[model samples]
Target: MKLVLVRHGETASNVRMVLDSLPPGPPLTDLGHEQANVLADALADEPVVAVCASTAVRAQQTAAPVAARHGMAVRVVEGVQEIFCGDLEGRSDREAYGVFVKTASEWADGRLDLTLPGGENGRQVVDRCLAAIERITEGVTGGTVVLVSHGGAIRLAGQALAPNVTASLAAGGLLPNTGRVVLERDGAGWRCTAWSGVDIVVD
Candidate 1:
């Protein structure tokens, strides 16, 4: 089985960095729509068996174009949704950066137990996303499966696939907005086949 993980396109919240402060839902912006379209075109030749996305509007919107192109239905999975920002939702970058930095520092320091106010911790997000991946793998015997999700969620998913490799959240991995990362099962483990949008070489 092959997995293609994609981050949703840009959004109003993304431009304003207010996603963590709002009520947990925000639709994509016009540019986001364009980005999704571009992504759809790029993946037109891939054999996608299923399309899954986070329940958030931005993710759903991003996945819709690709699903349509491939004549696949979009499956909503709450587990792939972005990390909840709690009290930080809807706040500007300047207003939330300090807290975000503090929380991120703590997270980097192995304090996975800490949760954002009204939000879930990295450990919880990873657990649910891993379950989601397991479910997808079970249903797909071969061919590519696409998952459109939030950046943070996708990052955690990548970590799950490559547990021994140390990575930074700020490095953005290879899956940028509208970008794709491919993972394939090998023997008793999973291996990264490709990571698009980053300069890193992929086999």
Candidate 2:
């Protein structure tokens, strides 16, 4: 099984730094739509058998075009939703930076027990995302499965497969808006095939 995990396109929350400020879900911005288009074009040729996305609006929007082009219905998966940010939702950057830094620091230091106020810890996200992947891979054998999700969820999914990569994956591992990373599973386990997004031009 090959899993292609993609982060949603840029959103108003992203540009305004209100991502952590807003609620858990928000629709994509105009630029986000453009990013989605590029991403859809990029994966148009891959033999995608299943398309799944987080219930969040941004993730759904990001997966729509690709699913449409592939003629596959998207299977909404709650497990891939962004890390629950709790009280930090909708707060300004200045107000949230300290919390983000703190959580990130703990993650970097290998303290998996630390959880953000009213939010999920890294380990929880990793476990759930891996479970979701396992479920998705059950029947499918060879074709790619595209998962549209948030940055944190993407990181968690990768970490589930490669626990030793926690620090590096948490250190902003180049998954820009609509970016993708591919992982392949053999008899042993999942292995990363590619990292980051590629430019796709559609005529």
Candidate 3:
């Protein structure tokens, strides 16, 4: 099974520097829609069997075009959602961004117990995300699956599972919106097939 994990397009909260990870978080900005279209076009020929997205509004919006092209419904899976922001949900300060980046990095480094105030632990996020993917591609022998998720979730999980693939994606310790990585099922784990943005027009 091959899973293409994509980050949702940018939102107003993104520019505001706010940590908006919850559902109905923030709508995509105009540029974000354009980014989504580009992402869809990039995967137009990818034999996508199923399109899954986080419950967050932005993730759904990002996955809609791709699902439409393939005539598949966007499956809103629970485990693939963004990292919970907890007390830093509404902050737009550098401190908030710093903490977010640090937490994600730590999670990638295998700090499963780490989390923000009132937030979920790294183990919780990765286990659920992988479980959701496993359930979706349970019986599929060879096919592609598209997953629209958040930056934090994708960065930490993608890097953890596919270190070499996400190496370029680590820009100042954050992932660019709409960037995606392809992973193939390897035994009980995953292996990166294509690093994020190798053929992408945008970084």
Best by TM-score: 3
* Residue ranges of candidate 1 with Cα displaced over 4 Å: 21-24, 105-110, 169-175, 199-203
Which digits, one per residue and each the tens of the lDDT, describe model 1 over residues 11-112?
876786665422247777899999999999988998889999887888889999999999988998767777777787667767576776566556544576
Which wins on lDDT, candidate 1 or candidate 2? 2
Q: lDDT for every model?
A: 0.73, 0.76, 0.80
Candidate with maximal lDDT: 3
Best-to-worst order by TM-score is 3, 2, 1
In model 3, the runs with Cα more than 4 Å from the true position are: 160-173, 199-203
What does candidate 2's lDDT look like per residue over 1-203, in tens digits? 78899998888778877745223467888899988988889999999999998888888898999999899888898677887777787776776868865685566556767787887787887778888877877888888899998776786677567434446655557578887877777456776666674322211
For candidate 3, the 10 contiguous residues with the lowest summed lDDT are: 165-174
- TM-score of predicted structure 2: 0.88
